[model samples]
Target: MEERDKQLLKMIRKQSEEGMSLLIDEYGGAIKAICSNVLRNYDAGIVQDAMQETVIRLWQKLSQRFQVKKNLRAYIYQTARNCALDYLRKYQRHSETDFEGVEDMMQDVSTDVEREFSRKHNERIVHEVIKEMEEPDRTIFILRFFYYETVKVIAETVHLKEDNVESRIRRGKKKLKAELLRRGVLNE
Candidate 1:
């Protein structure tokens, strides 16, 4: 942690309103981005609710006696992810397609229940594979597929050239498809 983050931690440990405000001022964008990325399948209201829930969870956790002192950013990111996933679980909203580019990964099922089950299972597998991916690839995949960000926006966010972003996304999809195939989850 930097000196600035240390100061923020100190303030947040006090559980004061100003401390919470400082925390938000420092990490609000990241929190919102995490929530938006995780809850992209849902509406703005759901994302906003998850963001608020993340903030509340942060406040509760940071004020604890055994709160995280180091790697505060990771904790915040994990909290945002958890809160968004909780909303997903609460509402049982699933993505309509198997991400943006992998629509053919799922085979056509005869029954709606089987289709839903297959989609949820395949989605879980894809998420697991993406989580195991390396840095720039993982971040690029999440931004591109989960957040539905354009290649140019992804390039700016990840500080890469547009071509580089496109290639990374392509490679990420290839790797994902391979993983799904290896796991016998793909239609092919």
Candidate 2:
């Protein structure tokens, strides 16, 4: 490692207050960043708590059986990450959704199921229309939409220029929209 890290480790080994202060001064921001990234979805207070816990854990480890040959930055990062995870496990609630407690939940679920069924039915109809399209249009539509292929890739696959591939996709979308409308899948 760097000479500074080596000096820091020596100070930590000696258990000096100046060493601890130097460690915090050098790594406080990085330790906080690690904790904040791990606990990004949590409140700022939670991140702060995890950061404090990391410093405590680091001191404990450094004063005891921490491997001398290990990299100090890596050690601090791992400690911060573990401390954040511990905080997450401690604070995160695992309560299940109480369906019975919420009276409208069941009713809302049934309507959601009906809407999903309608969406699937509409998709099947659109797929049928796409299947009826001729040759390269059918292949292009399948590759572009179904397989999520880029225009350049589809052009290479179909032996067509990029412009041709784009034009085909645009036309295919218009056709799909018209067919969807005719089949009462789309209104207005």
Candidate 3:
């Protein structure tokens, strides 16, 4: 935490809306970038919702629990990742297409473009796998790996009970690794 961040957090701790606004102005882009990356599809409405959720969570808890010694960027990233993941888990369930055609589509993209295409294709597969996960597991994985959120904060953001976040993280990693292997991203 920089001296400036410490000062800003102090102001925010006072529940000054202006301080919260300043925090958003300074950190919103980074948070949005992480959300967009994790969601793999961007909508202004979804982004705004995630941003609002993150800021509200921070405003509610920053004074009571935040430590000036912690990195604010990491905190913000964790919050944004959780917010986006929860939103996706809730809303994407009814919207996702089955995986039946995705592999076939990837196979036709041509050898010259295959490597570049494979990278994106893998991302799509990962996104699809995430969509299949249950509430807290899905949320936990997106924060842990996609946004590189720390375990402790991930726990706080998702409102899990005890080590539920960590346990979900473990299971989510195994599932993702299996999915990648099944997709041939990891060679047998």
Candidate 4:
């Protein structure tokens, strides 16, 4: 455990408001990102609710029971993921396709260094490709894939026709895939 983490632990165990504030400030974005990745396209309220539940769980349960003080990030992430998924199952808001992808996402990462490195390299290349895309195309791609928004919602939000949105999504994906393949990120 780093000295900073130890201090954070001390502050939280003592129930200091500042400690809680600091904890929220430190890990809040990461927790929200984790929730967003899992819960995707659910309203922002769902994400916020999941985040709040994670904080509460950390404060109420983990703090008392946890002995090791190395990192709270992973614990917070797991709690947020569970909270978001529970909310989803209880609500039944996702499509079959979305649900299918998430099961694979929840699987643990490979320990193989080469595979992990290649995966990350491909991810970077994909992000770079997205960054270089034109305006509505970039927005459309991010809305559809990253936020997990549906074609209808993306069309309405982007003020494009549904057909146009779908076309752009298809085109954007093709472009990204071609770029990745050319860069040797994908099997041809």
- Most TM-score-accurate candidate: 1
TM-score (C-alpha) between model 3 and the true structure: 0.51
Model 1, 91-162: lDDT tens digits are 773454327545454444347568789888988988899999999889888867655567876786678999
RMSD of each: 8.7, 15.0, 11.2, 14.5
Model 2 residue 168 lDDT?
87
Residue 187, model 1, lDDT: 64
Whole-model lDDT, candidate 2?
0.81
Q: 154-178, model 4: which lDDT tens digit per residue?
A: 7866789999999998899899999
Where does candidate 3 have its weakest 10-residue lDDT segment? 93-102
Candidate 1: residue 24 Cα off by (Å): 1.2
TM-score of 2: 0.49
- Which runs in model 2 stand beyond 4 Å of their true positions? 94-188
> After superposing candidate 1, which stretches have Cα over 4 Å from the reference?
93-188
List of clashing residue pairs for candidate 1: none
The order of the candidates by lDDT, greatest first, is 2, 1, 3, 4
Query: Candidates' TM-scores?
Result: 0.55, 0.49, 0.51, 0.49
- Scored by lDDT, the top model is 2
Cα RMSD (Å) between model 1 and the true structure?
8.7
RMSD of 4: 14.5
Q: Point out the higher-scoring one by TM-score: 1 or 4.
A: 1
Model 2 poorest 10 in a row by lDDT: 93-102
